[model samples]
Target: MRTLIFATAIRILTPLFLVFSLYILLRGHNHPGGGFIGGLMGSIAFVFHTLAHGTKQTAKSYFSLTFYKYDRKPHHNNLSHALRLLRKNIVRNKKEKPIFIWNYYLLRLRPTYLMAIGLAVAVGSGLVGLVMGKPFMAAYWLKVKIPLVGSVGTPLLFDTGVYLLVLGMVLKMVFTMSKD
Candidate 1:
């Protein structure tokens, strides 16, 4: 389903989507839009990009940008190189003389990590209220003022957690389905 029009639109619209999502996330407390909605909006950019290009191409351009290619040599096994080899997938053509290896060491921005960190942030936000002798998940505001977001609070943190969780979940699903 790759179309020239769609690809062009994606390239132009991706940044807009991300910026709008952030805006929604930051203005969530007073306005209608919040972390969950913001997260969905944010994930849509990448999902649309994936649809426009493809899984492999999107991953190569974004996720797995840095990779290594190597030929099958016996003596290339050093400590750091061996560690890299463990995460490599060897791709070969018909003759198989020149093997292409994709190393995953540089792909630190994984969806699972986002999910875990989001969950932790959400829970920790609730725990903050508990530690202050308030009920769990209660709102607790800090006495500082920020420019865009204004007062910092537990609700904002919880919203952020929801945003990350939703973004990661949707991206994970998109990536998983794209693989098939």
Candidate 2:
């Protein structure tokens, strides 16, 4: 099957993928690659690793509880860990895969439930605040005052929320699709 060969390729590609993903992630603030795309590449690399080895190996090498939630410490190590596990779910179903019900949608289990919930909270709060000022994506969001973080002058936190939400959702979808 392609899984075994893919596994070998995974070993070969993981390191390179990781290095490149990191480069992309770090440059995201200034360039086009940013956290979301960078996180996606990192997640794909880990998925390849998982396919080559197994979920247990994948979990040890990649997933952990620390990555699921948030970290208050300095630096962005948690983001790396979180992205790796975000989309990790059943890629190949041991049982029969379900057929799509319609073109409208299909159903699958997602692993980043908590992260999604948190994103909803942050985004909900952020939107309420944004509407109070100027409801626009590029209209100087940072200038809008937040009650806790500071005066209306920093939308970085909102961006962070979006990043987390997308990262978790994308990874979860990938993992689920693979499992199917």
Candidate 3:
């Protein structure tokens, strides 16, 4: 049932998102965007994918999110939020009932698990460095000193770990939530 027009449009747009995301992440090294924003942008591809195919099929593209995982209680907390967020714009803008708002707020994690992972990674990396005997958990500086940023120090490793953790979790979250 795929229309030629829809297929052509998606084909053109997916690569566009990927290219733009790469630019943002690379340029972000000194300016604004970075791997974190890049990850979210790249993740939007799957959201668009979900729109093209149904959720069950789209789920295949998100490797980490197993469809069967929801079988234990189908209506798990995160799953509920995922469905709600995905359907929000479609329903609300279509003049649907407002009651769904209540469900949205109720199931949505206050800070979301993505944020939690970032925090944990940062803290854990820093703590581990301290135990390693480098004062202030020297991450980059412990190894070598750069120019303007001072010794990269433990903060850099902590920051890097957190950055990676945040990006991975956010990308996964956005994809899973975009299900149709």
Ranking by lDDT: 1, 2, 3
- Model 1: how far is 5 from its true place, Å? 2.4
Give lDDT tens digits, candidate 3, residues 14-120: 77987776665555545433656765776566556556764555444443342222232445458776687578755676556553322111122222455676677
- lDDT against the true structure, each candidate: 0.82, 0.56, 0.56
Better lDDT candidate (1, 2): 1
Among these predictions, the greatest lDDT belongs to 1
Candidate 1 deviant stretches above 4 angstroms:
31-33, 60-105
Query: What are the runs in model 3 whose C-alpha is more than 4 Å off?
Result: 1-3, 62-180
26-81 per-residue lDDT for model 1 (tens digits)? 99966554999999999988899999998776666665545465555666667876
Query: Considering TM-score, where higher is better, how would the candidates rank from best to worst?
Result: 1, 2, 3
**Candidate 2 structure quality by residue, lDDT tens digits, 54-171:** 6556655555533233333454357774464443333545574442222323233244863676487446656765676756443234556445334432244444444556556666
How does each model score on TM-score?
A: 0.72, 0.45, 0.42
Clashing residue pairs for model 1: none
Model 3 steric clash pairs:
138-154, 139-153, 139-154, 140-153, 141-153
In terms of TM-score, the best-performing candidate is 1
